[model samples]
Target: MVKEIERAGIPVVHVCTVVPISLTVGANRIVPAVAIPHPLGNPALGKEDEKALRKQLVLKALKALETEVQEQTVFDK
Candidate 1:
């Protein structure tokens, strides 16, 4: 689906816990997720902290989208 969306000229940033899978699937923009259960938030953290972390991850993904890349790129937080 990611590839198909990009094929249609819409860029996608895939936030996932599995980096290898994202790479294998040819996701042009990839963001490292916190974990499988909670891809954007860590339950161990306080609610506000978790929200902040999620926001940070989303910001990183947005930055990745703005970046120019010749090949698949993974943005780490």
Candidate 2:
């Protein structure tokens, strides 16, 4: 779980379509995703576009990891 991972002193970024669930579970860093079926990428898009989208999400997650937060936070694209 995200909270458990953080409790171990490791930063975690929760990527999900529904942010409220991540907040409920006490995730410190949350990333709002595209959808439940395709949380990280839009399959309808061309392969290149999907790749770019995924890359952006990874970058956002990395940024979240680098930042310090005292409590729950959501990183929106």
Candidate 3:
């Protein structure tokens, strides 16, 4: 799906816990997720802090969208 979207001239940033898979599948832009169960937030954190962490992850994804990449790229926190 990500490859198809890019083939159509639309940029996509894939956020996932397994970055290697994203790269192998030809995702041009990738963001590292927290974990498989809760990719957006860490349960060990307080409620508010977890929310903030999720927000930061989203913001990083947005930033990755704005970046130009010649090949598969991973945006790390």
Candidate 4:
């Protein structure tokens, strides 16, 4: 799907929790989130904690949209 979108000359951004897997799948524009089930928030955590985590990871994902790179990338702390 991502490749197809890019092939159509449309810019693509893949926000994912799994970094290595996305690269294996040939994802060019990828952002590494925290976990697989909840990319934005963890249900087990308190509301405040979940919000903070989502905010941090979402910021990383947004930053990725602005940056340019040659190879596959993963945003990690």
Candidate 5:
């Protein structure tokens, strides 16, 4: 699906916990996520903190979409 979107000139940044699966499936831009069940948030965190974390992850994914890459890239920073 990610490749299909990119094939249509739409860039995709896949945000998920399973980095290897993302790579195996040929996701060009990937963001390492928090967990399998909740890829963007941590339940142990306070509500505000969880929201902040999710926002940060989203920002990272957006940044990845803006960048060009020749191979699978992990935007874990």
Candidate 6:
């Protein structure tokens, strides 16, 4: 699906927690989240902590939107 989208000339920004997987699959724009299963938060953590973490990562993703690059970019916190 992602490759198809790219083939269609649509710019894609992939938001994922895993870095290597996205690159291996040839994703153009990649943003790393917090986790694999739970990309936003961990249930084990407190609500406040989880919310803060989510907010921070989301900000990073937004920052990624402003930059232009030719290769795959991973936003890490």
Off by over 4 Å in 2: none
- Among the numbered candidates, top TM-score falls to 1
12-51 per-residue lDDT for model 3 (tens digits): 9999999899989999999999999999989999999999
- Compared with the true structure, all predictions reach lDDT values of 0.94, 0.91, 0.93, 0.76, 0.92, 0.79
Q: What total of clashing residue pairs does each candidate reach?
A: 0, 0, 0, 0, 0, 0
Q: Can you tell me which runs of candidate 6 are displaced by over 4 Å?
A: 6-10
RMSD of each: 0.8, 0.8, 1.0, 1.8, 0.8, 2.0
lDDT of 4 by residue, 1-77 (tens): 87788679776668787777888887777877667887778899999999998888777777776788677666564
What TM-score does model 6 achieve against the real structure? 0.75
- TM of each candidate vs. truth: 0.96, 0.95, 0.92, 0.77, 0.94, 0.75
What is candidate 4's local distance difference test score? 0.76
lDDT of 6 by residue, 1-77 (tens): 65678889877777887778988898877888767889988788899999998898777777776778777777654
Once fitted onto the true fold, the runs of candidate 3 whose alpha carbons sit more than 4 angstroms away are none
Question: Which pairs clash in the backbone of model 5?
Answer: none
What candidate 4 gets wrong by more than 4 Å, as runs, is none
Residue runs of model 1 more than 4 Å from their true location after superposition: none
Cα error, candidate 5, residue 2 (Å): 0.9
* Candidate 6 residue 35 C-alpha distance from true site, Å: 2.0
Error of 1 at 25 (Å): 0.8
Per-residue CA lDDT of model 2 for 1-77, tens digit only, reads 88889899888899898999999999989989889999989999999999999999989988998889988999985
Question: On a 0 to 100 scale, what is the lDDT of residue 16 in model 5?
Answer: 87
Query: Candidate 1, residues 1-77: lDDT per residue as tens digits?
Result: 88999999998999999999999998999999999999999999999999999999999999999999899988874
Of 1 and 2, the candidate ahead on TM-score is 1
Candidate 3 at residue 45, lDDT? Answer: 100
Query: Mind giving the per-residue lDDT tens digits that candidate 5 earns over 1-77?
Result: 88898789888999989999999988899999999999999999999999999999999999998898998899988
